[model samples]
Target chain A: MTNTTHLIRDARILGGERADILLRGGRIEAIGPGLAADGAQVVDAAGAVALPGLVDLHTHLREPGREDAETVATGSRSAAMGGYTAVFAMANTDPVADTAGVVEQVWRLGREAGHCDVHPVGAVTRGLGGEHLAELGAMADSAAGVRVFSDDGMCVSDALLMRRALEYVKAFDGVVAQHAQEPRLTEGAQMNEGVVSDRLGLAGWPAVAEEAVIARDCLLAEHVGSRLHICHVSTKGSVQIIRWAKSRGCDVTAEVTPHHLLLTDDLAESYDPIYKVNPPLRTAEDVEALREGLADGTIDVVATDHAPHPSEAKETEWCHAAMGMLGLETALSVVQHTMVDTGLLDWAGVARRMSETPARIGRLTGQGRPLAVGEPANVTLYDTSAERVVDAAAMASKSMNSPFNGMTLPGRVAATFLRGVPTVLDGKIQ
Target chain B: MRHLLSAGDLTLDEATLVLDTAKELAQVGGRSVKKLPTLRGRTVVNLFYEDSTRTRISFEAAAKRMSADVINFSAKGSSVSKGESLKDTALTLQAMGADGVVIRHSASGAAHRLAEWVDGAVVNAGDGTHEHPTQALLDAYTIRERMGRLDGLRVAVVGDIRHSRVARSNVLLLNTLGAEVTLVAPPTLLPVSVRTWPCSVSYDLDEVLPKSDVVMMLRVQAERMNAAFFPTAREYSRRYGLDGDRFARMPDHAIVMHPGPMIRGMEISAEVADSPRSTIVEQVANGVSVRMAVLYLLLSGSGSGTGN
Candidate 1:
């Protein structure tokens, strides 16, 4: 709905040759050297990388139930700040986004916020009970058009039920995103099972628990001839399984979270709940495998899984603490550090993994499009040379549970244009 | 010596100092004047989240013998039962100006978490299946008393090593003291990563028993049977339990110890438990002296100045 003409000058188009991008209405009007402004607002992006606005395949915008943690409006603002033009909202909310009404309501909230596009993910189970199937057809047919179905925080552990959900989603060209975990193997799991868990006396969440379920689901997806998306693949064993499944040509896509790529289970030595998370932070070797997997395109996207929790939920004993950390505001910086700074991926590769592939996985066409003329002007200006210490309190999200708090991270989102409208300008919300 | 949260935190020298100090304090147990004024004005709080009459009273007696004011905060009658968090309870204890906080909780790392919230010295009484440094100290003191030396001594710790905090603390502390220790338990009753521990592990107690100078039996909770850690108590007892015939395999000078509230005829025979070689009763008495040494060394400025 924006008509503001903007002339973004001397920005490296996907870290390539410098060009002037003229955004008119909601599409790119022109892209060339020294383009005329014609009374348009001029932004000096002389040293920034201009790529497609980022898209997250996984995000928990806790609304309609746990508004105390994060709402759609605040989560959308946080997303805009993170250079994300769109995010897939997880369905594990209070009322549970199982029906069409909840999905439509969540979609409406994102529209009203005007910061970013929020695609509501429908629950695969009725209440994520892992027993009966939810009304997946109704959710996909609703105004929200939920294409991704998941029982994210809780896994659909029942094998027969998982097969049915994977098969049912094929009616709408939908992809079933599974939070892969074998429930019994991970019962009373506190952190990663290893020498560390053995030393600390915390219950171990073994890698086989996640790998077993992922292996089963990949086979199910291949047998049913349906597309399956694995959410937040954490273990190195999981990467090998997905890579093996791809060799057999299973229509499966996988994502790795920002924290999983950087943090490891050794942080649990402090017994601080801030380090506590689901599929809990793994080993350094696993981190290397994940980075390698993402670089090789074995892992298609870098989903935020930007789960936020209230302070009370995280400030207690490790076992009593909640299971996620804030990721929307820190996702790109972590990727820049763990991927680009390591010389494993260039800026163009980043656009593919963080934006293009994620959008393709979510079936999002408006997002992940190239920054060429006549395309939707979803652009992000990133200052790759910049660095700042992450301050949890300064984040746009309602919760102050960022695990990266006080850690210096590279890259800053200088500006974000969502459909020609400046959602973020000069690193501040418009 | 700011916090005795884990037995692994102790060095050889620090553990020796505690044992030497406890030996001196053990003399006070035989004297008519059993009280020491070293910690006269200090306040010690026993903040127990789990019901452990034995551990709580041992800590209370230790603090009282040193003339420190003791306050027992059991979770049953407190605001903790009404949903007060551990951090909130820690802050409350902090407000009361506790010089040392002795905590026993059902959650592992609860003591470590409390250490972050309070400035006072923290002593872990027992935390989940994690560690009980004081219990290990007393067990170590009793072994040293009977064996005359810890170096080159063979020790076998049998039963539920997975859930026994005593076994974890003893393995770490005893290994630090230069004792060659072996853990004897069923594969399911032992942690999978026990190979990484400083001590050796075994499944057969009889094989480990004859080579031991000290045989310590850990209590196998009856509830562990329902969880199928073992098929039945009889099956576990037949394989790993200590009885007369098993005890006969130990060296003549070797001692039998249990961190008590014994599950009679299950993990140990009543006859062996009451045998002259058994130090079960003396371990309880030695617990007071060892805890007194820990408190004095951690709280008194002079003792802590040179301590770990």
Candidate 2:
């Protein structure tokens, strides 16, 4: 454990007033101009923007099964480098994180890794089969204390099962994150169902397939009085549904991925499998709508949905390749480029969408806290002016399937502090 | 010139040159000595991941007539069936000194990807529902031969336009040749992006049939239909199918064409397919000459004198 104090000098706190922060005993002791503390390691952050550590509501740390693609340790390191203090690990692993034993094991692995808090999301259904509900109460009461339940790689498509999963999560204040896709409509879908899919001869995944399930679940949640979360809302139609659902005071929230906000389905024109993803990148108009949704309050947060896959899985023809792209390491950079630099969101808004809202939606504690005294010192020092071309090979994740490779994105995480302990220092993992 | 990956890759001039060359080569097919000495030492490989006996034999015959060595590599019962990747197969062909590789795969853009891996010229014989450039060339040649020109001609492509690689190639090539093309199919059979294509679209084939110079019927594969693109075969035959009644509605000089192995009773009737105005058989014969021109131009380069 880190028992020493840290003195972060001359940093813009929350992109506001320049101040010095003194961390002692794993909490911010003082925040003021020219703060001095003896026997503390000094971090010179003159031009850096200090904000609350980011949290991801969706991330697939592929362990307990697909180690060739990613493991908990590697994914955690990637998260730390991306300035994330907590990540909700998805439940689509080999044996699937349905039981309390598996959830605790993943949680224990996260603790051992010591980079970030890996909150294991328990599978809503046993083995993610979508036929029967898993031991939701048992997983919530376990040491892992799963506060989020999902059958993410596969949607909980059955209406009865989805309603039941939503109802069951209310007992423990758990949120059921729905991967909103109708299975039959997306059976042979290779990309977004529009002009690009038509041109490429790949099967289309219609926007209605996602919107239909979301519209149904929102009504189910309203009927059952349980909190619902939508994972990776990719279409304008989905955003409209979520907005309408929120208008009626249904306890619903939605997230858009970094890739979906910036990339479009036109990238699939190259027939490159690297651009292939589930709920595939949509059109430019959809991208604009998603951006507007986030800029307003329609879309609640930005989740990485940081899926990782090995080279062989993504190196084949588009139809034959596995679906997913690495996102954890480049998520913030993409956000800064797409949202902040475009003048759509300020740094405070960035903290709200990336850190506060996601943590509140996932019910994560000791995260999404403001940079104030007596608060937990989970802080990220970012250089907003720094620009770097993304190189997938240089990423901390084991997988190099990032769609953002070679893209010039703004901002860089200079350092990250998890409870005053430097997990990433000077852009490198400690 | 180096690769025939798409019909869009050809300009009007290059397409006309290929058509003119095919016309010259068609005469060679009717001669007592039906062989050319243009590509004596060149090797052409037919790498087919999807089975297409018609396209494979046509390319083999084209290469043989040009006096080029030909190798037919079918994916079935081959190393490709043993999980060998397209890259490995392409590398193997590159090592074997293939001068041209004509590929037919079930995946779109397979030939384009193979072109990046090999040093030889790549020809997309048929790649999924993406494009079949030679078929387009042969169709254009037939249209020009029958109608005397492609400029301002009204060409109506009927049936499953969504799944027809032949229709896609023809639309692009025919558009480049200054022809006004119209796609006639049910809304489900038409691609959602058909509006972006260089052609107009109509749901009524009867309306389009009456005002066309050429009616090209794309084969409707019953096996490829997993969902109901149309109500039934009988209903599709009644609506979009080309029968003698629809044939009689066409202008006197208008021709009927089918990229053959036609579903005789489905997309076209037997009588309409065998009519004197039907260029179905001639399309097959012209396919060899067009492919021969493609193989010759790709392997020998444009400036090379015909080594008579």
Candidate 3:
């Protein structure tokens, strides 16, 4: 492995002035123009784009009980394929990833998977029921060194619970990733509550249900003066609230998934289970607002709330099917399509949203570095101009549940390196 | 291998194949092992974006019995609540290597869209009120098991006709099976174009009851009540509810039915639901068989006409 390691040239190093990057002993040993290529196995990088390994703050590995959906190994492989070097695994698995033991189980599995650095996010409340706080210190002290905490599947609905979780994580400098949606307001909500709901005759999942929670959580974050990370921030109001919070200098950060940027509630008219998302796809205005947030940095990171389901659950009636789509395989391409191809933002923003900022938010220090010397060899090489249609059959995961099938994508991840090892090369998992 | 996304696309022969295969699956469902290797290596995802107890658990039990790896994905508990789009979740499921997806959504065409997006087969559980094709299949299965045939039998679907997916599907299916379909409901309960239906409309339930072979009642969704669709539940039930009086009015061979979780006295009297001529509980049991058939035929086997 050491003898086969080498250097790259003509790469657009994100955030780095130098175009050359040298890798030796799992870190960039040198990065400069016209560096010697002697005794090195060289990988040509003429006209290819390089980004710091991406980071995801919200992802469900579904281990402990639902490992069949995704274990750390499979999920890490997905992250690698999506050009992610680190991801904060959500805490809503069967056992909830609430306790130190469960979080440790997740940590060990990520280590065993070895495709990416899986940061275990301990639950804010035991079982994520929003009733009681979990042992934050114990999880942070565990081998995984959990730094990001969340009640992802469930919001810490109790105001006191949210406050307590925020203050508690302060001990470990942990950021509380909140899944915003008021518990009582959202029960039996099958679709986004508005014109679509009235038209479809299904119960409405009101946007206010999410926006209200974001508003409440922002206030709580401000009150406690503790860092808060909003997971999968949807809609214009939530973005506005987050923007206000950040302007007030409150320690609040937000993420918007790739789908929110590209799709909207019009698809709901189809009454298709494939478009039945949680915070159900909002209006086109919301999509535009999310795009603007992603472009101008109102949204801090682009995370794949990568959730997988068996085909049976997803195949049922619209009101009975699950509400998620697999995202890791197409996150970059989507960000590139909706943000870059449209020319709203440049490669620097792509690197920030996909790579650098997520690492900072999740506290993954070894990741999100410019491709250069003496930096941990975490890099994603891509062809910014490639065009290909996405097919679930060709993807690496066991599930073929992607919504991008047959849709042409203009961006592609060509190679990814994790600790100086090529986990992916030529668009194939190595 | 999983995810029943739509009813419109399935051929009649294909629909019957699922019904027949479900009959085979029912025999083995209660065996000591209570499992099969049919879907052992396969992964089935239960992706319900809406609130569902019968449909969700039915699919859950069906997949588990087939020995497929099952992942229960509840939207209430995922990032879906935040702002993650359905497509993102689909990509995530694809990345997890889901071989099959059983989905129920609130939207009308969600399942069809899913079929377009993924590699697995699509099964339309129900998309909006446009169709609940499987419910029709199951109801037909129950009718076939009891009435011996579908040709030329009179079946009256009563109450909340406009709001009931079950009614719409049953009407289409029963007429296809050669049954004389009559939709009995107040003018308010009928769709905007009830006149377009091949079936007859009866405002007089008592008049329609004596002539019918199957008096199927639809659950009156209370949520739709605010629209003044009907005068009141009491009035609606008095006119359309199946009680001993209505049961006695029907021909001796006529059976009563409802696609269930019946509102009890609201849809039918307790006695009628439990009557010899009533097939409500049998509907629940047949649901498994009907669903098993849908899964079996959709996943691997031929359509229902083949004896096998």
Candidate 4:
């Protein structure tokens, strides 16, 4: 926390009325029309939209193992640059964050980096092997205070095990973020199982594969009377299932990735591995449905499944390539382009989906707070009118696997303040 | 055409041009000197990541007949098995100044991926169940030769449509050439989205055989039985196999086609394969001409786009 007061002048608060916000003592000191700077460092944030700093519920900071791909420091820098103040780092890492020691190390690395808050999500299965449960209670009890447990890269396919996990996390008020893909059904799935995969001769990932697991997990969560969070809902059927699960009064929350909102399976026609992802990009109908689901509040949050892999991992044949795309740096822009510009969502809705709900879902107290007085000074000023072509090399993440490369997207994060300190300013990492 | 990576990539004009060029080139096989100077001094590399003696020999014969210097790089006992990536292998081929590369690999989209790395034209001989544009071209050529046309002809592509690159290419190429293609196979052997394809599908081979002007039998791998693609070879043969009775039911002018090394008495009986109506031998002979036309078009500037 910095004592140096900062005054953000004339910024639209959540795309609403313009106001000046004062930051002091790690909290919003004041917010009103024409507030005086009072000898503080003044920032000219004219025409930018100010909202609560974004919080990502799903991010892969490949630390303690695959550091060549990403470290907690690099990924934290990436999150902050993407207007994120807090991000829950997933547990599918080397040595796996199933143990308290691993989770604590990741949490400590976040603290040392100080770019953004990193809450380590515990593993649901030991080593994510899908057999025995990890020490979720111990991880929640540890200094990291993990509130999200997931086997995000791999689905927790075992029904009894999924039920037990959903029930087990309840003791600590934790949520199991399921990856939601049936392993056997998606054994050799390379892309969406439809016209494109058929034409390209790549293996198909059926929508039922995801929907079946989601349907089962929703029932499991309901039966166990525990909170279930679905990760990266990619299909229309999945949206319907999740919507049904929600209407049934199942305590469930779901997140849609930024990539899924804008991209589709047609990209796989290029045979480019950059567009290849798990629960692979679906059809245009699925994209529209996902957009509608997010717009209608059926989808709870927009999490950047910011999976980064080494260039070599993605620079190969589509089948031989790894399944993921860099998301953190381009998440906000994609949200703006697909949702805000398309009139499906407004700035406030963007805040709710990208920040508030994600922080609430992860149980983070300081993040996703309103841009008002007496709240934690985690704020992001986004230039919504600005647009630039996405360059993978220009991104902060260690990997260059952004699917949005060369595509122009609206809204650049001008500044991101984590607890009154600027982790990113003037669209550059501070 | 810079690369004949997928039959779907071909337009009607391009597909027709390949067939016409092959028809003219077929005359060379009957000449005193079975050679064309169209691709002389050009280097063609046959990169086989999978063992395909037949395909390798066909491409080699085509390139050699065109007077193009040919280099056969079999993946076996080569740097490919030593864990060298496809990109590295492509770079090595690029370094050797290959003017056109005919690739056969066990991974779908390997040819597409190779096209991205190397500057040479990529002719996908067979890329795991993805595509075999040359094979489709040859099949198309043989059909046009035997039936005198491709338009409005009923071609029944039978067996293992899910795992047959030949079936995929032929379905696409035949469809592009204005032929009506019916994919005949068990539900387990067909793609989930086969209904979306520009072709009809059937579960019963006997029903399709009577209507088809050309019946193409695909080689079903015996290993697929272990995964329960079918109950047993005998059971599969009992239902889907083409024997004398089944072949007799076809239209009198209808020809039998197979992208061979066919499993005798399995997908097709020996009697049917040996029948005069069988274009199996001519298909192989026509393969050389079709491939020659493909290499000539992709390598020479006569085609719309020169190979990069």
Candidate 5:
């Protein structure tokens, strides 16, 4: 093994003391004033803050199904590069992760790669069919130990089925992450239902379609007495529903993607598939509301929901292209831009939303831990001020499908420690 | 610059220039001996992948009227019937030494790809469910000719906007020309994202008729009605259709318009189609002149002139 005598010098240590962290044997040995290390390899943390490794609650590693898009190994590396210590991979693989065997396979692959922990999300139903329940307990007991369940690619449209799915996961405390789109309202849906769709002559995916589902699910969650997590909460109307639900003391949490906070449906005027995502990019007003929701904790976490696809799949016509974009590698930069750059969130807030709150929600133990003595050294050291235009080729994920390509973004990941092991160094996946 | 993809691609400045150029060409048509040498050294190909009569002939006339060498490429009873690909047809057109290509495909955005891949100027005659820029320009030209201007005019576009490419191009160009447009269609016919468009929208045509300086009725295309956007043809015509009774509510100077092949009993009544105020026929005659303007502005190589 390499010499592990590493010293971080002159840093505004995020956990508060004017300290130097000395590392050895893949663990933080000590951190205090004037911690001298003669044989230490030096790292200049000059003006940077040391935060815990970021983690994502939703990411799609389109492997074992559409490997031409993304794989668990590649996705894990992407998470690490993004300074994420762990990611909950969604359960919408080609065969669908409804069973224990498939999820365990994904888990095993993540372990083999060893970049970051890949917690495979189990499907709510067999093949996500929405008719019969899958082996939820078996998956929860499996090696993956999936705590999150979802039928993400399709909405669990049937009211009774949605209620049943929410109730079924109560024993495991698993969140039935609903896609929350009414299929009938959104059939042939191309973009946000507004004046732009009328002008563009494209079909509308209405705000109501998403709002209705989230409203119904929140009440169902209250009735079922189970936790529910709504994926990619995009609208102001949705925020109102979640806000009301929380006020009523219903156990529900919501997430908004980085794209939702930054980009709007106006970008669709170009008809670029890169901007074509599910719960399609909304208006600027929605962007503002979503950002406020995140900052105020109405929206609890910033999940990537990083769906990836091959170039060929996205290169077709707008109506015909695959729905998704690469977000894992760009999530941190987007968060930094939307929150920290705007001064809406400080570094600690970024840590809480991206790491701490997500960890709490996903029930990812040993994660989102503060940088303290005797704690697992899951840390992310970042250059919060450096800038780079993201190139898709440089992403660790297999699919080069990010919309943030050629986008100049501030903040860069310097290093990420997963279980005290440097899984990434200076933005390169280890 | 390479794809003439649609008349919608033309800015107001460009459309005005094209219209002015068309005025000169219309004067040439007025002469007993009608000809031009501007396109003598160029080649123009009309590639119609779908059914055509007016659009095809207008191009043949416009190209021949400009003295350009012309080729008519029809997909009917040809390899396209045998399911020849668009890329294959594009390659075939490239082989024929054509400098200008006018394509009318049933598929929308086909022209967009054609423009990207081809070396010559690609004009969108029409694609499946997209901007028919020339049809819109012609409609605009016919209005501007009779009304003397486009700015501040209240124009209502009524019919199946979800499937109509004509509606797409018109809203963009009309707004650009400083005309206020209100689209009147059932919620099914109107796209979900209509809120983003720059025009006012209404369900009732009678409500808009009093304010409109021009009421342009689009042809009700029956073959394109596939997923049941409206419950019945009669109901769609009843709520959103331009009939004589509905026409009675229009301003005294407000003109009725249709981009031909009108459904006499469906979208508009026979009385409204033949009304003295209806400029439906004027639109057909203006089509050749306006298309000539597009060909001239796009082909004449800085051959700038004034007729406006």
Candidate 6:
């Protein structure tokens, strides 16, 4: 029971005018220039930019299995440190979050952890097999009340199954986030299909493999009049398709990962598996196109897709190693460096893309609220001028597979208030 | 060089040094003693994840001729099959005082990964479809031994260019050696990014055969058609196969070469493979001397001295 009152002083709200914020009983009591409350914990937040706490629509907690890689408690702590107030945990766990029982168990674990609200994303297929549909209605009606369904790690490749899943989710106002990839076109794929894969003689993962699926799913969603969300749009061709779909007024939304907006396939030249990912990192032109799409609202939100792996999974040879990188802890810093600091998006735009829009997409009612009176006190204070050299050993997650280990990135989270309860203070988890 | 992982890492001077050393070392194959004391105390380990009896034996013979101790570690029946990772295997070899590791893996860039873990010199035998640097060296040696020069020679590498590690290394090395190389393969057989390679690509094999001073044929795996890369074995052999009719179009001084265990009826006909112009047999013989030169240059501090 967190009932403590907190007074945050001289913070810039939403990159706007500096003011004092008074939070009491998990609600914003007042916002003014010189607010004072007796017995309130005073946080000297001068020169910090305050925004709505971030929300991640895609994060892999790796619980109920693969605890050696990450657990709910560890992953949530990482999210809280990254200024995320809510996260939709992915459905690619060991038992697969397809049944009501699994999602309820994950929800209870998140409540116990008390760092961030964990919304378990139900699997659209049984065990993500891509053959048959899972119990979508049961999961939506469960205590967890899963509103987002996805077969993230594996694409719902079968067309009929995808169309059925999209239509079924509409009954409960749930969105089907598709991991767009054509399996046959990406057989034995190692990296992006381009000059780099050819020079290295590695197997090529062509962009058409991803674009073909997104194009098909968009038309299917338009036909069924169901909401569709594309996960991890990685190619320029995908951006063009998504832009065209939005122009057609289809109930379609898309997300670009923090990695996709910054990193490119040239990093794979080192043969380091840490750069390996699904839909593989693409070219510089693709990165620019994704940034443009996000700026123009063609892409709806920025999802972390925070995948963690054990050291053994990433330390092996490139082809034999797993395909993911740590993103939760460094996601905000990357966005600030690539998007905010570059003048592509302002702080208010950052709040909408990173917090408000993701919350709306996942239907997280308690998150992504404005810093105003009577709203939920979920606020993040960020020192925008500060720089951090990412250190994997110092991270909250259990795995050390961070691709940004030695990178010097801008901005640091000073404090994160999850429902007026300070989960992080002075850049340290409380 | 500390590592011979890719032919692209070699300069013209370094490649010429290797070929010149192999030329001097070839005479040792005929000597009664046949062994050199240059690397007498060194240890070389052949860590092979893929089975290739010919390459393994050639490397073994090269190491033995230089009087180095050899240990062969095959993936089958080894700890590698027992779930031990490549890093662990490399650490175990490093602990055993291996001075050099000759690795053959099915994954591209495996040798580069092993080089980062071990302190010894790493030599790539054949890593997936990436590179086989020593094979290129031996091919270069065979070409130079026959024609006595590599400058401005017209070479055509035909068939299965997309899946051939040998063709990749040959193109890079031959281009560095001042030879103009043409990659002759069906459009489906060539990689989509072949335009970026330092060679010209052609679908017609016969058109380039007459102009080619050296013709190298890469083996075509029958399993490629399982992915629909080509139609059938008969059709592929008819169009791209180097029969005697295509061989007659080549210049009189031109040589035919194939890295062996040749499929007689598939990529190259038996007549062309057994012809007097064929250097296929000499390629195998030159593989040992070229490997010896590489091992000596990498391990010994003799500064390219003759192994007397």
What's the TM-score of every candidate structure? 0.98, 0.97, 0.64, 0.97, 0.88, 0.98
DockQ of 3: 0.12
Worst 10 residues of 4 chain A by lDDT: A1-10
Candidate 4: tens digits of C-alpha lDDT, residues B206-240? 88888989999999999999988899999999999
Each prediction's whole-model lDDT (CA): 0.93, 0.91, 0.79, 0.92, 0.83, 0.92
lDDT for B202 (candidate 1): 93
Which is superior by TM-score, 3 or 6? 6
Off by over 4 Å in 2: A1-3, B224-226, B302-308
> For residues B74-165, could you state the per-residue lDDT of candidate 1 as single tens digits?
89978999999999999998988888999999888999999999989999999988899999999999999998999889999998998888
Question: lDDT tens string, model 4, A1-430?
Answer: 3445899998999999999999988899999988898987898898699999999999999998999999999999999999999999999999999999999999999999999999999999999999999999999999999999999999999999998989988888999999988998888889998888887888889999999999999998898899999999999999999999999999999999999999999988778899999979999999999999999999999998999999889878889999998899999999999999999999999999999999999998899888889999999999998989999999899999999999988889999998989998899999
Residue-level lDDT for B244 in candidate 5: 77
Runs in model 1 deviating more than 4 A are: A1-3, B302-308
What TM-score does candidate 5 reach?
Answer: 0.88
Model 4 chain B: weakest 10-residue lDDT segment is B299-308
> DockQ for each of the predicted structures, in order?
0.72, 0.59, 0.12, 0.69, 0.35, 0.80
Q: For residues B203-293, write the lDDT of model 5, one tens digit per residue.
A: 8887889999999898877754556777778887888778878888888999999988899979999999999999988888788888787
Q: Is candidate 5 or candidate 6 better by TM-score?
A: 6
**lDDT, candidate 2, A112-186, per-residue tens:** 998999999999999999999999999999999999999998999999999988988889999999999999989
Question: lDDT per residue, candidate 5, A161-234, as tens digits?
Answer: 88887888778878788899999999988889787665555678999999999999999889879899999999
Model 6 fnat? 0.73
Q: Find the candidate with the highest DockQ and give its number.
A: 6
Q: How well is each residue in B58-147 modelled by candidate 6, as lDDT tens digits?
A: 999999999998999999999999999999999999998888999999999999999999999999999999899999999999999999
